[model samples]
Target: MNLENAQVQMRKGILEYCILHIISRGEVYASTMLEELTAAKIMVVEGTLYPLLTRLKNSGLLDYKWVESSSGPPRKYYILTESGRQFLSQLQTTWEELQFSVNEIVAKESKGE
Candidate 1:
């Protein structure tokens, strides 16, 4: 695959976790969340993010409130629900395990070469 395609594939694996971690930090508007993710070099569009947010909300992992915005009518700010915090904790554990496994494999491959 081409470099761009490969990068997109890589991001698909972790985007959900990344989004949860970001939203877990505090209540955040969609625009701000997009900015933060983009600044972190994760390419995401509203189309992608909104659907994921809706899914998370539907799953009872997130709660949101509408806040007045200077630029717009009102914007929805999302924060983690109690269940979301619990889920994030579990996700963190899983992420750590995956990171350790990947690091070990990479280190082994490097040492073998």
Candidate 2:
């Protein structure tokens, strides 16, 4: 596959985790989230992000409030729930372990071990 297709394939698996981590950092509106993800070189459309946000909310991992904007209609700002913080903690541990293991494997292979 081409580089773009390959990148998309790789991002598909980790996008949800990355999104959650970003949201967990602070309350953010959908547009801001999209901007942040794009800046990080992770392209996510509203179609993808909205559904993921809905699922996270449904799972009680996210809470949102409608905040009135000065220029436009009210915007929904999402924040991590208590459960989300706990869940993210667990995910962080798992991610660290996976990263360590993958790094070890790559290092060994590179060394012809």
Candidate 3:
């Protein structure tokens, strides 16, 4: 099996959910968002994040406002919309269920079940 590809696919599957969780904390700048994701070893580039953020915004799951920066022209800060919050709650529930299932499988395998 292609282990590396599988790992990448697994990360990609949860990336959107992680991004939403991050934004649900508060309104955040794009650069800051990139930093948090990078620090978590989830995503690396503005290129990847920008498109996802735009898509989320377009879907009415997120909203943003341009905030003037002291060192830069302006930055778009994002926040979860009402719909976004609801969607995120659902994601959290699904994530918990999936995590539990995966852990159960791992435990069974480790025990040679």
Candidate 4:
């Protein structure tokens, strides 16, 4: 098995949660989100991000507004809906639980348990 493949799968698994968390902070544009994700070493691209955004919107977890821009075409800014907020809250709890469980297991392994 390829370790690189596993690493990619791990990143993909949490991409949605990370994106939702970022949007929860405030309204954001795709480029801004992409930049932040890159800075965080998430290794995402526009092609991957756009489809995920559409899926989230279709699921009623997100909404977007098109704002006119003087530089060029209008930009779609994403904002979390009430349902999105509630969903994210649930994800937050799940993440914390998973984090604790993973840390405990890793700690045991490190001790040669």
lDDT of 2 by residue, 1-113 (tens): 59989999888778878878989879899999899899998989999999999999999999899999999999999999999999988988988999999999877755546
Report backbone clashes per prediction.
Answer: 0, 0, 0, 0
Winning candidate number (lDDT): 4
Judge candidate 1 at residue 13 and give its lDDT.
83
User: What lDDT does model 1 reach?
Assistant: 0.92
Clashing pairs for model 1 are none
Q: Tens-digit lDDT track for model 3 on 87-110?
A: 999999999999999999877745
lDDT of all predictions: 0.92, 0.90, 0.90, 0.96
Could you give candidate 4's per-residue lDDT for residues 13-100 as a string of tens digits? 9999999999999999999999999999898999999999999999999999999999999999999999999999999999999999
- Which has the better TM-score: candidate 2, or candidate 3? 3
Writing each residue's lDDT as its tens digit, candidate 1 over 50-73 gives 999999999999989998879869
Q: Lowest summed-lDDT stretch of 10 residues in model 4?
A: 104-113
lDDT of 3 at 6: 90
Candidate that scores best on TM-score? 4
Q: Please report the TM-score between candidate 4 and the true structure.
A: 0.95
RMSD of 4: 1.4
Error of 1 at 81 (Å): 0.7
